[model samples]
Every structure is written in structure tokens, then in C-alpha cells.
Target: MSDSQLISDFFSRDVLLGDRALKAAVADRGEEALRLFIPEQEGYGASGLQIEQRLAKLAASIGANAVDYLIRVIRNGSWQSMLSAAPAFAGLREHKQRATEGLVDVLKQGEIDSQRLAIEALGYLGADDLAFCISEFAENGEWIPQRDHRRQPSRYHLDKFYFYVAQALIRMTASLTSVNAISRCLRQFRDFLPICDEVLGQNRISGWDVRFVQHNFPSRAADPLVRDWIASDSHFLQDCGVEALGHLRLSRTSAFLLSVLEDPRFNDSVRKTAGISLSEFADAGAAAKLAERLNSASDSPGFSWAFASLYAHDVAWPACDEFVEELLGQENNDSEISAHMIYSLACRGDTRAERSFSALNSQHLHMRGTGAIACARFNPESAREALFGRDEEANNPMELACILAAQVHAGHVEKVDSLHQALTTFGELPFLRPIWKREVLYAFFVAEGSDSERGRLWCEAALETPRRVVTEMQALLKRRAREVSANRLPRSQAELASAASRESQEVKDKFDVFISHASEDKINLAEPLYHALVAAGVTVWFDKTELKLGDGLRRKIDEGLARCRYGIVILSPSFLAKQWPQNELGALMARETVSGVKAILPIWHDLSVEELLRQAPMLADRLACRSSEEMSSIVAKILDVLKD
Candidate 1:
């Protein structure tokens, strides 16, 4: 076949023999076949989703085979061409020296746009040693925004360089010192790169990139800055700020968001932003807090917003269960503001929404679209008619992609033409791209198991998603690969039931936490810790509370030990020296040996790991929360564990 014909075959779905068709084509037709993808020749009309898939495929398949050609592409091609070719080195991480050298050479000599794309690829390559050198290169560089034929500037400006620098730095070195270093670097170089409109605190430093950084790599260092953003006068900034804090999902951040919902000064939009972000805190305390706010005479819709956020992520909490009846009582819930209540209850599997959903789904386009999305998530197969009924009615590409994804999420798919249509439309959605990518991936994986040609291609395509997402998909792929290798699970219901019958065992959890401590330390540690846990909405079994006058003390203590979800052992000098506490510790350890569940949560009070190692070596190995930390902080940590 001619070279153009070989390149033409790259876009042909009928030729999906395997993941490495590009590498195979290279073996047969030489390096010329790679040009179809590397520079991404024009006129094929590849959509956004297909382009991403091609990039990901090249990254996974090209490996070290095309390292020299890719390097030449970087050295000789335009910055846009360099950007197009960069994903290939991601596949070459194991053989990154040649790619890194080429990319770094671009960082030094190539244009600013080239430098930005190169540093990003370097971070992907895990090249940390070159950070300081790269820092020097960016120190004095000023951005001149890319322009169109009409001479209008692009969406992002020159200061975006700083944001990219910080992202690369964090990916290379994820330490507090590194975070602090980058924070200062931004301050020193850009003096707080504002949002150009998004404002980093010092002003608009084109912080759009920085926000993406915070979302993926949240740290305590950004806590104060994020708070200020939430407090800002601009509702837009406040929305961005609240979203950033939500990403952190710490107890203190949750507390701050609750305060925002409580405060009357903030506008409805800002309050609503605060409420939606609270979905990140899927803990009992957060849900209970929202429920408490609702039980009051207040009229904030933020509480329901928080609930739907949790439900959308597939998390359901008992704390939100009590509000379903109250949610049903709300009027005009089909309206945009109150729509969250509909999603919150529906996704939680509440039957009350059945009538409301039917009405909503049959309403006008806007309400029907909302209804279809919520219903699809609640019951995908049932939502089929609504999704497609509205699918052809809508003209928007983004809406089309969303409907396609909703259909996939609901366990339905389309013919090749529809799948290709989904591929084209998904590119229009930049932020929602990853989610839609997973939807396409799931659709493919279901139609063709991981061993099939299309399945391997889709898996390779998904590897070039965001770093955190890539890590998650890699773990899932590894696990699925292992399961495929063994293929030992029972196939029939009878076989599965027999296997399950052999392993049938159940344990009831009466308390969220059980505090075990010596009476000598009760006044200082145990009693205070007990009150704190209770205040944080955790059910605890303290001997003082659970041990009644007529109770069998030893038997009751044993019951508390076995029934609690987690055992908080207050390990101190007194606790370690006591015989009773040691016996209790032995019981918890025995439970682990039998069931293989790590249930012990240790709090070191006036005790060192070294001393504990001498007395009880087994307990010493488990990391303990230091008593010196604030009691609330300790309670927050325990709540975090319960959340997981």
C-alpha cells in the first residue's frame, strides 16, 4: 500500500486488530506511518475525543521505538507540533533520557509555548533533578499570548507559565517544603499570578492552571489562600475558591463551608457554591451539619445541594436519611434552585421521586434534560426512553455527548455510527472530557472484554488522562488484568451460592468507636477523647457510659471490643503499664488475625514509639495519632478514617 493509504487506514475502525496497529504499521511500512498521528495531518476531521485517543495511543504504543523521530519532531516542528507529539514520551518514561534531553532542549531554546508543553511532559516523565534548572529558565520569561489571524489574544495569557511551573514542581516533588517553595516561587516571580480574572489572592495571576493543581494535589499550604478566595467580593472568585476547599475535604475545611452556609451576609450563589462543595465531605459530621441546618426555620437550598453532590459520587450516608420526608414536602423543587433536592433524594434511591421524576421528565426541554440525567443515574436502563427521546431533539454537541454518556451509564449503547458521533461530540467538552472518556471506555469494555482488540485500544487511550486519574485507572487495569489471568470466579449462580455459603459470616457494629484506656489516664485523656468523639457525631462505647451498675464488666468490655467499627486505644505510660489494657490489646490483635481487618486506632499520650516497642512491639508498629495535636484535630482524623 502507498504511504497515504497506510495513513488513511489509521482512521478506519474496521482495522482495529489490536492496540499496537501504529507500531505494527511502523514495522511494515517504516516510520512514515507514524506521521498520520504525530503531526496529526489535517482534513481527516478527527474530533476532540478521537484526537485525545490518538495521543494516548501514541503515548502507549510508540514506546521507545519512535523516540528518535519524536525527538526530531520536537526539535524541528512548530510548538503546536511539539505539543501534538509530546504524549509519545509518556510511553517512553522507562526510556525517558532521550525524550527528556530533547524536551529540556526545547525548554531552553524553543518558544515559550514549546517550553510550557515540554515542562509538562518532563513532569510526566518524573524528571525531578532538572527542576531547579527549569526554574531558572522560567524566572524572567514573560508571556506573550498566542493570537489568531484577527490579532485577538487567546483565552490564557503569559503568566500561565508560572502555574505550569508550579504544577510540574508539585508532580516532581510532593512535599510540604516543595509546596512552600513553589508558593514562594510564584510570589517572587509573578507576585501572585492572578486569574487574569481568577485571582490567586495577590491578584489575577492566570491561576486557572493553579486551580487544576490544587484539585489534584491538595495540601494544607493552600488552606488560607483558598479561604480568602471564598471570602472574595467576586462571586466568581468565591465559587472557584469554594471548589478548591471542597477538593481538600479536611474537617476544618468542612467546618468553614458550614459557616459559609450559616452566614446570612453571603449571596445565594456564594452560599449555594459553599453547599455544593460540601459534597466533597461525605462524612457523617458534614451530613448531620446540613441536616441540622435544614431542621431549623432557615430556607437555604445549600443543604440539599451538598446531599446531591455526595449522591452523584455514589456515596450514601445514614445521616442524610432522615431528611427525605422533609425533602418531599418542599414546593417548586423542579425549579433550578431546588433541583438538587430532586437529585439528592432520587440518587439515594428514594421512591418518592418516582412521581416527581415522571412529571419532570415529561416537562419542557430544560426540566426534561435535568430529569433524564438524574433518572439515568438513578436507574440507567429505565431512563433509556427519555435520554433518546430528547437526544435527537437537542442540537448541541455537548448536550449530545452528555446524553450519550447518560445512556452508557444507564447500561445501553448505540450502533457504530452513534458511537462515532459520541466520539466527535465529546471533544467539545473540555472539563467533562475525562468523565465522558470513562463512559466511552465502559461502553467499549462491556461490549468487548479487556482481551479484545477494541478493549485494549480503549485502555491504552485512557492512560493519557490526568495524572491522578491515570494512577487510578492503572491500579484498576492491573487488578482487572490479574482477575483475567486467574479467571477462577464461579460462573453460575449455584456455584457462587455454594462458595458464598461456605464463607457466610456477619458482625454487627453497635458503636462507631470503642475507647480503651487505663483508669489512671481517664481524667486526662480517655474522658476528654470520649466527649470529643461524641460531639463530632461519632457513636462511642466508653466504659463509663456502657458499663451499667448491674452489667458483667468483663463480658460487656469484650462485647464492646468486638462490636465497635473501630477501637481507639489510648496508649500512654499508664495504659502500657496496666495488665487490663494489655489484655484488651491482645483481644483486638486476635480479631485482626482471624478476620484480617485492621481496626485498631492508637492515640499516643505521653508515650513514645521507642518505649512502646519495648513494652508491646506489635502495637508500636501501628501509626498513632499524637495526643499533643489538638483534641478536635484528633477527632477529625478519626472521623476521616470512619469516612473511608
Candidate 2:
């Protein structure tokens, strides 16, 4: 049959090839061919429903294979593609995991459209069990927005997927709301927070745009949703609702929100927000909680924001020793909150800050540096103990930076290291380079007027390190140091070379992924197929999932083929014309030959076996074919291979 005729037949009643034909098609062509038939086509009518029922029956017959095909179909298809194909595979498994995996895979892929599609499909699928997935994604606020071609300098980068997902959570699925309102409430807590406008600009007001701001504060002022949320026994959701009330900035919600703070059911975070929100309403009750929390044992750094927001600066001073002790425990405290807490302690200049800074050892660069800076600003003499440490880890660039800051602020020069290890060994993490940078600059200024050769080398090495922000600050410090230095020193070439080598080593080790797709066909189909392969012990190397931190699509594909078994190209029209996929197919074949394993698998949807080969001789040569006739056969194959 001609290609157009098959396309036409796909929409015809004759397309209902019964169970046997459906099985044959999937087994011969793969799941895409079976899924291509539009169930609601105009000509199929009631006969179409009957055909679908028969297809479902056939799918059940080869249930294991059907599951595999469903996995394949879900992983590859876009949100629209999933929406189109989901109903047929619903009865295949009621695990909730399959659907969640499909959505999470799309989100992880990081395509603006794919993320949106995944979110929208979650709503349409009407499965409440996937609510946690939605909540987790929403909390991250990392949704990347799609570029709009229609607008000149577009005003938005909305992910329609998330918007749809939110609507789905509220309107379509009862799993979250009905099963356990508490868990459901806790899951969406972040949704009510003061999200950055940058994050908000990603999603625009659509047809069913919910004025969540307004919804939290009804005009009648007695909405049950609002009331229930205010009185929810679940502390997590109540905390969120309190913040939601604050974000809405509604005076009407003040009483309801305040009432939550008094309820013993609410947690510390909720009571905190409730107090802050009620403080806006001048509710005397909120003031009491703030006072109580300030004096309470829960006065850890995590609640610094709540305290700061309430302008309880005086209350923060007493918690300094505890905060400093907690700070030494791990590098896990919220950076923003810790910064504020340290700053507050610095202003207090009490014995606690002095004792904390005095207790600093080489073992705790992060905490000692933080304490040193804070203490130095208030009591520079307190940093002398931390400054004298000789251990490389203890006397790293970060510790030196803080010690130097304290010395400069106090007008006292203590001990300065030679060559300053220009690449400070602070914290053992690459990402925390900036923190050490600040410390190094402060240390550079402290070596002023010193005749020591080590001081000169330290100055030169500090100048040689490369952080634009640190560089600019260093230039300013160098001028200040020149005024203080008894003898001027030129830049050290050996130190620069050593620093360059270390930076190069760090830069070269970055990770990445490679995606191969059929150009004309939708990306929707490729998503699930990629993920299922990943879940089924296949090391997937797709750009969407692999390269999260940066873009290295080509590099990733090449590297993946080098490391991965082989590439699975979705053999569609788009895949044929695209040079990337062709190149990938070539590489995959080469890898197969090298690895001595079947590499390129031809996955035909509606395309004939002959046509598929005609389109890509490379894929045809490498193709180790597997056919899926319907859901049943796909699941059967999956279970057969996936299970022992």
C-alpha cells in the first residue's frame, strides 16, 4: 500500500485489524504504528469504540508486551502525544508509578515544551497519585519557559504545562484531595509562597487562569477552602496557607490566618508566617508568637527569615552562640538565612561572638570564615586564633579571607601565608569558590607593610586567581596594599601557571548528554522511549535528561555512544532529514560493531519496513527489529525482557 493510503487507512474502519492484526503490527512495526490510528477519527464512529475495545482486549492478551509498548509510547510522546495515547493504556497498569515516571521523565528532559506538556498531561490523565510529582516540580521553581516567536520581545515565558498541571491537581484528580488532604496540602505548600517574579513571568494567565491570590481571600470573606486551609490539622499545609494569606496581602484573611498561629496543630513555620501576616493586621496575638519564638529553643538559623521579616533584630543577638555551634556542624544551613544570622551577631559584638570566633580551628573553614568576618567587623581581635592556624585546609583561602577581613577592620596585621595557595582549598566543593574569593581579598590587604617573602608571594598569587568579581575587588585591594607594602612585588609567573593548570582541570570534567531524534515526528514519542530504556538498565544519553547543568548536546551524544551501549533513534520522518540523527546512527553502528552488540534498532510507527530502510540505509543495516502489534504484545515483550 502507498504511504498516503496507509495514513488514510489509519483513520478508516478497516484500521481496526482486530486483535491478531494489532498484535502483528506492533510486533512487526513497534508500538508507534499501533498507536498512530486516531481513535476518534470521523469515519470510525461507534465502530471505532468497538475497535478500541477489541484492541484493549488484544492488549490484555499480550499484557506483558503491552506494558513495554506503553512504556515506549509514554517515554517518547510529548504531552499532547501522551494525552492522545494514555486512555488506551490506562487499564494496562494501575500502579500510578508508570504515569508518574512518564511525567517526571519529561520534566527531567528539560525542554520548555516537554515540561509544559508533562504538566498538562498530568492534569488530563486525572490521576491524583501523581500529585507529589507535581508538588516537587513546583517547589523547585526551576520551570524553564518557552520562547514566544509571536511577540516582539515577548512579555512572557509561561510553561502552559505547569498551569495545566495545577488545574489538573485542583479540578480533575481526587487522589490528592480526597485520599489525604493533609498530604495534598503539604505537597503544594510552596505554591503559596512569595515566588520570584522571574519565576512567575514563565506562566501567563490562560483561559482558566486562577486568581489564586484572590482565591485565598474571598470577597464574601468566608470561603470554605480558605477556612479549611486555615484550620487544617496538617501543619505543613497550614504554614503554606499562612504564607499564601501573606502573599495575597488581604486584610480580610488576617483573622483567619491569625487563628492558625494559636492552634496547637500548627508547626513552627506556620505559626511564624501567621504571626508575620497578622503583624501586618496589627493583631496582638502574632506579636506574642514572635516573642515566644525568639525565646524558644527552636531559635535555629532556619527561622532567621521569619525573625528578620518581623524586624526582631534585637532578639537575634542572644541566639549567636547557638547559631555559631550549629554553623560548625555542617554546610547545610540555608545560606541566605545564615548570612543574615551572622550579620546580626556581628552587630551585637557580644562575648558569644568573641568566644565562637576564638574557638575557630582549621577544620571548619566555612563556619570560622563566616564567624571571623562577622566578628572582625565587630571585634577584630577575636579572629587572631583562627588566623594562626597552619594546616592547609584550616589556613585555606576562605579562612584567610575572613581572618584578613577581621585584621583590616580591626587595623591589626597578624600572620600571612606565603603564595597564599592562590587556589584556596576551601570546603572541598568547586561551586563554593566565590566564598573563598571574598576571604582571599581581605587577607591580601592584611599583609600590608610586611617585609616577608611569603607575604609578597601571597600577594602575587592572590592577584593571579581568576574570578571577575574577585579580580575587580583584588585590583582595588592591590592599590590599597601598595600604599601599605614596604616593598612592591611583581606578578609571579610560576604561581599563575600553577593556578591556570588547576582551573583547567576543573573545567574539563563537566558532564553532558546526547539526544537523537526523528526531525519531522513529534518529540513527544521520543521522551518515554528514552526514559524506559533508561529505567530498563539502559544508560540513556539524551540531551533532555543528561545535560542538566549545561549544554553539550553533540559532545554528550558522542560521549554517550562512547560510554553507552548504542543509540536508539526514533525512526520517523524528522529523524531521516536531520543530520544529527544520521550522524548519531552512524556513530551507534560503529559502536555496535566495536561493542559487538546490536546497536541501531529501527522503530517503525506507521512506516512500512521497506520504506524505513529506504529512508535510512544505516538504520536498516543495524536494525535488530522488534515488533509491537498492540498494548498486549508490547507489555509481553517488556515483562519478558525486564523480568528475569
Candidate with best lDDT: 1
lDDT of 2 by residue, 249-338 (tens): 333343455445555556666666665544332112222345554555244322444343222123323434554555333335444334
User: Tens-digit lDDT track for model 1 on 81-146?
Assistant: 666665445456667687787777776677766677777666555465566545444444532222
User: Which parts of model 2 have CA positions greater than 4 angstroms off?
Assistant: 1-263, 268-345, 362-369, 381-385, 388-644
Worst 10 residues of 1 by lDDT: 488-497
Candidate 2, backbone clash total: 52
> Backbone clashes in each candidate structure, one number apiece?
11, 52
Worst 10 residues of 2 by lDDT: 213-222
RMSD (CA, Å), each prediction: 13.7, 27.9
Would you estimate the TM-scores of all the predictions? 0.53, 0.26
